[model samples]
Target: MYRTPALLAPLALALAASAFAAGEHDHAHEHQPLHGGVVVEVKDVDYELVARPAAVQLHLRDHGKPADVSQASARLTLLTGTDKQEAVLRPAGGKLEAAGSFRLAPGTKAVVVVTRPGKPAATARFTLK
Candidate 1:
């Protein structure tokens, strides 16, 4: 009857809206860590941050391929409770690394900013668990 169509119209519209929103999201991007680090995606690139008590390492991948970071540098800001610390990471081997004693623990948050000449900086936030 006419009432049946009217009642299904709202459901159809809701389903269509959800499908549209999902199609626009990048959930298909691979989020698995390549170096046992927390991975975050920014601007179609994936950044992995590995935190340890003795050193920190960052890895970058674009479209599932290793990104060239030879001319890149990174700064990291780590926040844990009321204590905060910072470190500068430079290109080492093929990744950016900083060597120092760090105060890392569960629930810590880290913000990383990577900069390269003639390119905009890429930033990502990670929470350790």
Candidate 2:
């Protein structure tokens, strides 16, 4: 029932440090994309998918920084009602882009799979609005 200050100080510091680490991990998936798009976390990486009338772009970020996905390839599948379409995305600048007219309405469902030469594939699913 008797504890010294030296013993309590280290215990308090350890608890505070653990709480801070938990907070950081909880906020890792709550990132807002620089470009207006939907962000999904795949294998601890953030992938922001932007659907436009003329193109579909996928942006990669690792720990809140831009990730080089130039050597990566991606496949996008879009489903609207009973219709489905798929496209191959090629690297363009800082993102992977596929140039085609896509029908991304409020209820469209999308699934994207990205693969690199020596890395396992990662998938992200989204519903458009």
Clash count for each candidate, listed in order shown: 0, 0
lDDT of 1: 0.91
Task: Look at candidate 1 and give me any clashing residue pairs.
Answer: none
> Each prediction's Cα RMSD?
3.0, 5.7
C-alpha lDDT of residue 78 in model 2:
94
Candidate 1 ranges beyond 4 A from true positions: 1-29
CA deviation > 4 Å runs, candidate 2: 1-30
Local distance difference test values of all predictions, in order = 0.91, 0.87
Query: Which candidate should be chosen as best, given lDDT against the real structure?
Result: 1
